[model samples]
Target: MAVLSFDNVSILQEDVPTLQQVNLEMNEGDFAYLIGKTGSGKSTLFRSIYAELPINSGVARVAGYSLNDIKRSDIPFLRRKLGFVFQDFQLLTDRNVEKNLSFVLEATGHSNPDEIRFRIEQVLAQVGMSNAIQKRVHRLSGGEQQRVCIARAILNKPLLLLADEPTGHLDPEVSLEIMQLFKQLNQQGTAILMASHDYNTMRQVPGKLLKIEAGRIFPVNSLD
Candidate 1:
């Protein structure tokens, strides 16, 4: 089944249309790249999928929820099925890595302390950050911080992962490490839809391409 689908959908930010008549689909275990120039509606489209931005029209479904008709109360449930990684590595600066991750678990209704710790360990291990559990966010390198962000996102075992320029700030070597981590997650049965500006990295780790331009989305035939 498709983890995400948008048919003739329009995305709007603050009542201004950003993408029009967008049609797309992502299936289970599918890994795809969302490529576009800045301000070309890539982030807006991502927001629409996660219901951060309202769908102005048409059919949209993600993680088995109908986005167009989703109620406010249902938004949380919709988000639970999605793991979002952002470019800025939005970790809480004041908290240690474990606390940051624990906050997510607590907010998501995970009350059992033992289970929370086990799950946290599992995700941190997945991202190769098990050793940084007690480190403060300020002390970790940018790549390590991003790994924490990824670990936090996967705490719920989301059906799809939505990443917006996850490697935008790191050096090429660090960026490659993060990409390899993402590829590993995709191989382990999670679908990924990542928005990226680094065309070189896209070429190195090729996948289905969804290119957005002038408020439209279409598949690219080749990276060349």
Candidate 2:
């Protein structure tokens, strides 16, 4: 199965349609860019895949869950298959980077001390933050913090990584570094679907591009 998908899915915010007849699929090892103006349904589509927003019409099968009428109990399972990265770091201010990452792994059922330590080290290495694990959240730079967030997201070795404007708060150089990290993860068969407005970042790297506008999706470019 494709890692993530939308089949004629439509989303509504009260009476307004946020997405219209959307149909798309992202395969394992695939990397794609999703872009549009603000309020153009970029987040609406992303949220729909994670079942954050209920589908008003059509069908969507995401992370192996039938989001059309998914059960509440099924949500946790679905979430485990996806690594969601947000623009905001959302780290625990009171905890160091290691503790913040450790909390999620334990909350998600990684209890072995050896395994937990190994998992933390592995993800940190992936994001080039092996040295920042012991640093307090406030002490790291904005770019480094965001990298930690990405590391936390992938600690479970998720099947798909969904990032919504992952680099919105970083400078160009830091943004490029973050994007390259994502590219590396995708190369290892972790499907990636990123939503962003940075046209230059997407241009330099290679990926399929889907543009969203006025509640619709379009294929503006493809480097597959």
Candidate 3:
């Protein structure tokens, strides 16, 4: 099944166009990399998928929620089934690793504490962060923190995972490790859509490649 679909999607910020007529798809258990130079609308495209930027035109559906026509109240619910990870590691400053995952579970309506704990452990283990759950966020290294971010994203058992420049701050080896982690998640039936400017890393990862160039989104070879 197609976990995400965008048909003629357009997005603008403050009357300036960032993305234009982007149509893409990432199916279940699929892994695809978003590649482009700076200002190539990579992040803008990712934002449109989760409704961070309202679709100015055309249709976008993520986990069955239409971006062009969706309710304000429905936004939070839409997010529950879609995992979003950032390059900057957006964990709460005051919360420990466990607390961060717990916060998302409670927010998403997982009231049973025991079930939530199990879910958290499951995701952390999936991302190889099971041993670091009790550690504070800052205490972990950059790669470890990113692994924790991945753990939290999958805790909700999302149908799709969207990561934005996931390896921006890591060294080459660490970035490779992070990409492997994403690939592992994809293998386990979680569709992944990641936006990154890391050309080398994107080339290394085994997945289809999509690129944004000159205000258009299409496959890399199409640009030629």
TM-score of each model, paired residue for residue? 0.97, 0.95, 0.94
The runs of at least 3 residues in candidate 1 whose Cα sits more than 4 Å from the true structure, single-residue gaps closed, are: none
Q: lDDT per prediction? A: 0.92, 0.87, 0.86
Best by lDDT: 1
Tens digit of lDDT per residue, candidate 3, span 52-124? 8999988889898888888989999888889988999999857789999999899888899899889989989
What is the Å distance of residue 146 in model 1 from its true position?
0.6
Instruction: Please write out the lDDT profile of model 1 over residues 1-224, one tens digit for every residue.
Output: 89999999987777788899998999999999988888898878887888888888999999999998899999999999999999999999999999999999999899999999999999999999999999999999999999999999999999999999999999998998899899999999999999998877778887899889989999997766
Clashes of each: 0, 0, 0
Tens digit of per-residue lDDT, candidate 2, span 4-64: 7787888998778889999889888888899888889888887788888998888788777
- Better candidate by TM-score, 1 or 2: 1
Ten residues in sequence with the least summed lDDT for candidate 2: 215-224
Alpha-carbon runs more than 4 Å astray in model 3? 221-224
Can you rank all candidates by TM-score, best first? 1, 2, 3
Between candidates 1 and 3, the lDDT winner: 1
lDDT of 3 at 172: 92
- Minimum summed lDDT over a 10-residue window in model 3 is located at 215-224
